[model samples]
Target: MKYFAVFFFVFISNVFFAQEKENGTLVNGIIKDDTTGNLLSGVNIINVNTVKGAISDDKGVFHLQAFANDTLHISLLGYKSIKVKVTNDWIKNKTTTIQLTQKAYALEEVVIRPYVLTGYLEIDAKLIPTRENYRYSISGLKEGYEAGEYSPNAFGRVLGSIFNPADMLYNFFGKKPKELRRLKEMKKDDTVKNLLASKFDRETISALLGVSKSEIAEIMERCNYSESFVKTANDLQIMDAISACYEEYKILKR
Candidate 1:
């Protein structure tokens, strides 16, 4: 009876330790420039699965809560972004260092020709291309508009996302309520907004939201955003669109 009691106590203690490690722990990390070996500040660090974020201080040090296997996306303007995975070692050691490579751009020479006004309404109107934006809204849902490209099936797409219980948007955003809940938090952070504004690639947003690039494109399409906007808009614009769409989705489901 004494032996059995000792074994049971040991088993329970081991099980609790394993579960605590699996859930996660706070990890400390430092960011630096790969070429210069200097500490980089204001870098964005986000846990993709948890949607929890941290920014590197002036000393390029940051700390975040992360589980083993969780992906951490690190990004800074004018530098190539990189993702790092949290290993069991990282949780155990509790510290890591990441270095980012700066992006280079070549300047191209160009000749500029200024447009001259014809001073005639008909001639000027013909010379200048007109940009028209269209807005489409569903009957029962809140009012909103899709700008840039117009789709013939826009109504059907928006209606399906709202009315169909098993739609992709429903499954995608619904299953990850905690992740989507951080959209507002990301939007409110100026550092995040600035970083996203400079980036055209959907990597940061996709990683932060735990979605793939293809899935992001589909979500935009379903939300009635045009192909042109999805292709050209920066990550900040995409984040805003997703937030708006998610808000509407939450309202409709309620």
Candidate 2:
């Protein structure tokens, strides 16, 4: 009887351990194309709440750290973006399959302008119009530069941002405290950084930051980021800009 009791206790402990391991923190998933039923690879999977990111392999499989109530943003180049909310059932099940529908792209009309440039350097320069811009620096900030056009009110706007950093970034980072808090987590993930570094589009950043593209531009502008950087920088650069600006704002608040 003693031997039997010991065996039963050991068996129960093993069962409990197995159950715990089965319901782990990682969510395993396979992605496929809805129309063709073909496995899709290179899909971007991001846990927006945690700011953890992963990419689907050639086998169309991906694993990401997620939990109940957290949301996952899945996207690819040609497919429609999807948001999957993690549920208690999903946590228990531990595996899922997602299908993405292809996005219908409509081509817009394009007008091609023929540029007639003479062989002279001065004449070619005259053919292209250039806008003059200026950068202003504010004291007591780290790497702060206000970019503005060569206009009458440009200096005043830059001065306003320099003097009142909080007001400039309040609309961008104030209301989205939960999302902004994940900035550090985002910077820690090498996969997320690589994904952002290669992409020019702000889609992933927008989803992670919970802001629109226009809002992102506006926020960066108010934070004294140069217009050239705001318009031309990669997603990783934009992420760094937001992180720096938010850190400055936090320090200023204290």
On lDDT, the candidate that comes out on top is 1
Instruction: Please give each candidate's TM-score.
Output: 0.65, 0.74
lDDT of 2 by residue, 129-230 (tens): 675555534322356344443346634544455456466465566678888888778878887877887777898889998888888888877666667767
| lDDT digits (tens) for residues 130-231 of candidate 1 | 644455442222664445224566455655776677788877877888878988888665656677777788989887888899999988878778776678
Please give the distance, in angstroms, between residue 88's alpha carbon in candidate 2 and its true position after superposition: 1.0
Number of clashes found in candidate 2:
0
Clash count, predicted structure 1: 0
Number of backbone collisions per candidate: 0, 0
TM-score of 2: 0.74
Candidate 2 versus truth, CA RMSD in Å, comes to: 6.3
Cα lDDT listed for each candidate: 0.79, 0.77
The local distance difference test score of model 2 is 0.77
